[model samples]
Target: MADKQNVVSVSDRIPALKEQRKKRANRRLIFYLSIFFILIGIVVYFQSPLSHVQQIQVEGNYTGETREIIDQSALVSGESIWSQSLGSAKERVEQIPYIEEATIERSPDNITHYCPRTDRTAYLHNNDQFIPVYGNGKLMEEQSLDTYPSDAPIIFNWQNEELLEAFFVELDKLGSGMINHISEIHPSDDDPTLLRLFMNDGIEVETTIENFASYMAPYPTVARQISEPSDGILHMKMSPYFEAFNPEEYAGRFMKSTLIRVMVG
Candidate 1:
């Protein structure tokens, strides 16, 4: 009887050992699967299409060549998405002098989008010819209208990006629809300066740059303030603005002029 009891006990111990071995095998399988999935995730991240720039879009750009600018930026055409660093790419693109700010984003489809930012547009004067004027207020050499394509107004030569930027800010404050009839904007380089706007109605507004917001803050006031149809070039280059009854009369008139002598420092 004692021998039989011992045999049964041994049999039970065998099954228990087998059960323990099966649990160990399942644990090992789970461990290998976890590692495999992790490796796959890493491979997918590195191989994603977002790793390379697929599209480049430039908005509010006028004078700068879009393709040329993109080529100069930090974005490399082909690379692994996981290996590519977004912050590093942005820093590189922003290094280009013209691009004030840049933004990069990856779409759901894994395409990278690069956008270069610019606040102001260069208004090239078109008078049978096109003249490149920096948004700040510097007048670049005149080029043929065919070369520079834009409908922005022509102003006298000046080189102050800050002033032009201010004008844009003021325009935003006043609302663009207020100047629908405006054909051109001429800002003078003098104290108590003015922005001479030529309207399509054969009239012009001779208001100081400082008073521009207050005067044209409302759209309806523009037509009512046209005391007289401007006969010629309007001179807003003074404190108490006066219309150039004969604009041609002041053909080369300026209260102050800053002749830009380009010196690369």
Candidate 2:
């Protein structure tokens, strides 16, 4: 009986080994099911519309048509967000005149955003047609129009683009009130650096490009002091002064010329 008790039971050992194997099989099956579910989630996410750009939005100032900005970017709706080329789109959008800078971004909500900063500072007068000029001095000649645009002053017969751009930068200091009064501006025949401005209130002005805004700042006050603004010219090149036309002397001189011609004949 003591020897029989010390002997291990083969049937009992078999049941314990089988129980350990079953636990291992169950663990393996659960791990495989978790991995399969994860893969399915990834596949569903990529195929969903939320991962694509369904619309485009723009914020901030853009003077041109919204369609033109979209066309220039070459970004199409319904394209995959992962495939959207943000860098190239920004470069193309910045190529449009008056757009100083452009930036693009996308979101998981199926939207693409584009923003551009632009300024229409002036206009170039070309006969009956006109071209839009930006604050950075970029010209939009392609969008020229037959009708006159009164929003900005007309720059006529300007030959140098570099100088014109610099002049525009100087004009900003005067503020909108002074700038709007400027009807037309032309470079002097003798010196392009000298600018001749035609005021909307019927006064001619002469000033240099270096300090144009500062010199013209006193115009409204000076104009108010003058009794007759239409019959004189304001010189702001160095010292501010008004030179009035002597119509009586001019008429007398004309009479003398006609008298001489009549007597000689």
TM-score of each: 0.58, 0.74
- Candidate 1 structure quality by residue, lDDT tens digits, 34-108: 999999987776677644545545554565566655565545556544445667766776665445666766543
Runs of candidate 1 with Cα error greater than 4 angstroms are 1-14, 33-69, 92-101, 107-109, 114-150, 159-165, 172-175, 187-192, 219-221, 224-265
**Shift in Å, residue 149, candidate 1:** 6.2
lDDT values of the candidates? 0.53, 0.73
Residue range with the least summed lDDT across 10 consecutive positions in model 2: 256-265
Compared with the true structure, what per-residue lDDT tens digits does model 2 show for residues 18-137?
999999999999999999999888788779876777788766654547877888888888777778788988899888876778768777744444555555667888877889877666
Error of 1 at 243 (Å): 7.5
Clashing pairs in 2: none
